[model samples]
Target chain A: MTLRTESRFADPDAAYRLLVEAHRKIDPEHGPALDAALVLLLANHIGDPAVLADAIAVAVKVVSPQRQ
Target chain B: MFQFAYRRSPDQDRSSPPRHDVVVVGAGPVGLTLAIDLAQRGRRVLLLDDADRIGEGSRAICFSKRALEVWDRLGVAAPMLAKGVQWQVGKVFLRDEQVYRFDLLAEPGHKMPAFINLQQYYAEAFLVARAGELPGIDLRWKNKVTAVADRGGHVAVTIDTPDGPYELEASHLVACDGARSPIRAMLGAAFIGETFEDQFLIADVKMRAEFPTERWFWFDPPFHTGQSALLHKQPDDVWRIDLQLGRDADPEVERRPERVRPRIERMLGHGDFEFEWISLYRFQCRRMERFVHGRVIFAGDSAHQVSPFGARGANSGVEDAENLAWKLDLTLSGGNAAALLGSYDAERVQAADDNILNSTRATDFIAPHSEYERMLRNVALGLARGHEVGKRMVNAGRLSQPSLYASPLSTPDHDAWDAGPPPGAHLRDVPLGDGFLTDAFRAAGCRFTVLRDGAGPEVPGAAVIDAAASPLFAARYGTRPGDAYLLRPDGYVAGRFRAAAAGAIPAALHRARGAA
Candidate 1:
């Protein structure tokens, strides 16, 4: 919520909750693929490649914390 | 000479002059509604119009949920409902093909009533006659406001009666005069706006065949130089038809049936139909630069004039009076300051803007800018039928009667969010159980309702405005479960949040308290 990541949202909301809702439709385990897809889709909307990279890095770090 | 009173306090003798807390300049829908709304609140009111007989012109045939709510508040909606036709579907004709249609019933019911097909004359006549019977209400026809001058603390209005020019004084003045509002122009207020170059012909006709009881528009006239025609069906096989006047077409020529008959035959497929009335209109999308200045306020076509396409022009004006009426009462009764009056412009300007957009959009499609515009609109209408999103978007355009009064000046809430409006700024959902948000506020008799979802944040001043997921409310507003929005006493969505907006309730209260 600190720096703007995307415009898919009217405003940033609890991302985990959105992911949970998006995942509830297809998968239960809350797959990393959906998280990655959401990050890339929102990243593309964020427009600036540098901003996208940063948000993606943060999102990846959040979803795949072992990489941290 | 003017006499002010709290109610229908009877005169002691012939020496006692007639008393009125407010004297409305006209007995049109807005004027009569204003008088009744005030009189119902126990304020003595006298309504006057220059016309000798009751209103006869069926000028505005479309009534919004906002208007219905006002009628309900006056306890007159049930009778109107018995006579009025609730239109739930909209059909558009791109030549022979039915290209665009919106099922208003597709949305669930809420507090709002679905759009009704009733003549403005009927509404005005009903309310005026009914309000006349009410104590402290005197509807004097043939009495016109000749001139008005502000006398410092009070307003002096001159009425040119058949007897003579009688002088009257009141606290405030409202100009609801039609396009040619003498009071607005007399006050030297600028009605800054544009007039559409395109002129059109409108006729009320009686046809033996049954046309669908919804408004139907023709984008491109199938015959004679490519103008368009719009048709609205009434109860007794009466259809109001509007034929667009093309760019090079002479409006003077088509002012009567002789020149217009062929085009009507070409577009509606019958010039043989019986004609009740025929007239030509040049749509002027204009508004007063200021709704309020000094003590005189403008309402109805006097303040803003939009095309008849979406029927928001006069309806919004009704809302203007409704909003101003309550605030006027409060201020006159020492409940609020005159600063609250500024919101009349704030909200009504936005409402006028809304009507302008909807009207221009509809007219733009019907009267295409170019061949490309015509083709694009035709194709969009073609696509609009098959695609649900397109249909919903099209439907959204049809129901575009939003009023934005979320300012610190006149809004109900003491709190306002400077950050900007919430997510549903562009989203329009009809009210539930309450009826159309416009009419519900009107029907509530301008009482503040706290709109909530059973348990939510409670604002100190407002009426609790909650949704019951009520089928009735949803039917008119297209609102769903867990949805709630608070409206102004005049029926504009003051602030709404799905789930909840960060500072909505407080923002509403701040605006309300500031207005109060």
Candidate 2:
């Protein structure tokens, strides 16, 4: 199956606020672990390994120092 | 006020109860419907129950369209539909915000709606009243089946009454005893499955509420913090509410009026509601491996059970009755008994699995087992606010629907049809002249019915209905003139063909009757 790339959120800013609000009570050390957990959970929800791998690659390309 | 009169069973004579064609244990909806259907089909049925009166409480409030059709065959749907609340729309919410709404029955021109909310007690009462009218049904109240012995050809059962005990023999013994089935235990059959740890408080309250007669489900509603809630309107101004209590909740404390009243108050925003019945339940999704054990068969809760989320429990049981009644009737009338019962086991086990799968998924979504699961559920719900895909993923009990039996009984499709129900699917009710299609089938007496759109060669041993003049028939069947469909006794399509293929209809009939 093809990986879905269309934006699902109607309001991206509102979704960002929800994501930030989820991490607001977390400490610096726990924050990374929570983020990692969230990533794994989302990956599981995505289910297809190829789609998840593509998503990971896209994130890495966006965050890389050379790209920045 | 209870309308149905409870009559005590006659004292048992020392000799023995007379041998019967079919002895149905437990006088609940399943057993009663089975008995009525069998009696209508010319089988002598003896119905026994330990209870003196109908079931208490507004248990199993939602009856699906298929179940209503089945009850219609048993001659009780008109009263039920008149008394019940029909609804199709369900709204799902995340906390205080409504995420999405769904219309279950989108198509028009159907006889019954997607579902009708009626109390289980009223359903049983209607079935009982219908059963009393049939000549061949012998209903015995306060008579319990204490001992069961599977004799090679028949089942020998012992009944215990207030006065004394009596022995009886039946060609077939059908167990409709509820989840805690003594017959299942007596036969050493295992009822096995998973039990959800989370408990839910179900309260049936009589109130004058302005809430529409629609299903309203909530995930972590503000009234009941961190737990899911459900509200449904039943007949007689009664509202059924379910509140999720965590795994460690004590059943005793959660059932008290002082505790339940506040939860209802928070949801209703008033103290006008009075409790009709309140109970705490930790539902288990379980079933016996084989519904048929020698000459003794199981139906309803005794055969299988699911968590009450999807309203699969009683509706599936009624379907079980519907599926088995005709098979048993044929068996008693010298049809191939073994193969027909085997088909019943295969078809119903598949249905039970389907219900269990849906119920389990709904439970997990409503009460997530782990922190990770909870996190993912929250994300999904958050996404559901705007995304269609996320809204589709939200499972507030995938409500009960009839499962198409992919059994050996169904004669496979010979040619491709674009629309309407396929082979193994129940015949959709369509308006025909002054009445509906099912009404005609009922008047024809639960036989193999062949419907043709226009002039067609008749198949032997099947009743033919000409639907050439009815556009509704043509639309639902997706048939042109001269196309025909072979229907089973239970109103399921056995086979369909464009023209009369020599020997095909008879061969399909043999397979459907389990004579092949």
Identify the candidate with maximal lDDT.
Answer: 2
lDDT of 1 by residue, B1-516 (tens): 121222221231224333345667776777777887777777777676776655444488888866776667677788677777778777766556675676655545334456787766667767866786788676666677888887677677777766555666767776776778888867888877666767778888777765667777665646634667677876557778787776666767777677766766765676668777788887777787778776777788888887787777667767777777777776677755555677666767777877776676666555655444454444444444444323332321355354555565433323333332332231234455535543444444456554544456665566665555444443333344444555555544556555445246656545654444
Each prediction's Cα lDDT score?
0.62, 0.85
Q: Chain B vs. true chain B: TM-score for each candidate?
A: 0.80, 0.97
- The parts of candidate 2 lying over 4 Å away from their true place are A1-68, B1-11, B14-17, B500-503
Mark the 10 consecutive residues where model 1 chain B has the least summed lDDT. Answer: B1-10
B1-516 per-residue lDDT for model 2 (tens digits): 334333544425546566788999999989998999899888889999987788787578999999999998888999999999999999999888898798999876677778999999989888988998998998888888999998797788888877677787898999999999999999999999989889999999999989988899999898988999999999999999999998999888889999889889999899998999999999899899999998999999999999998999999999999899999998988988889999999999999998997787788778876665576577667656665646766778888988888988988888778877888888888877677788888887878988778887777888888776775888778888788888989988888887746358888888898996
Report the lDDT of model 1 for residue B514: 46
Residue-level error in angstroms, candidate 2, position B231: 0.6
State the C-alpha RMSD over the true interface residues for candidate 1, after superposing those residues.
Answer: 18.6
Docking class of 2: incorrect
Q: After superposition, how far is residue B33 of candidate 1 from its true place, in Å?
A: 1.5
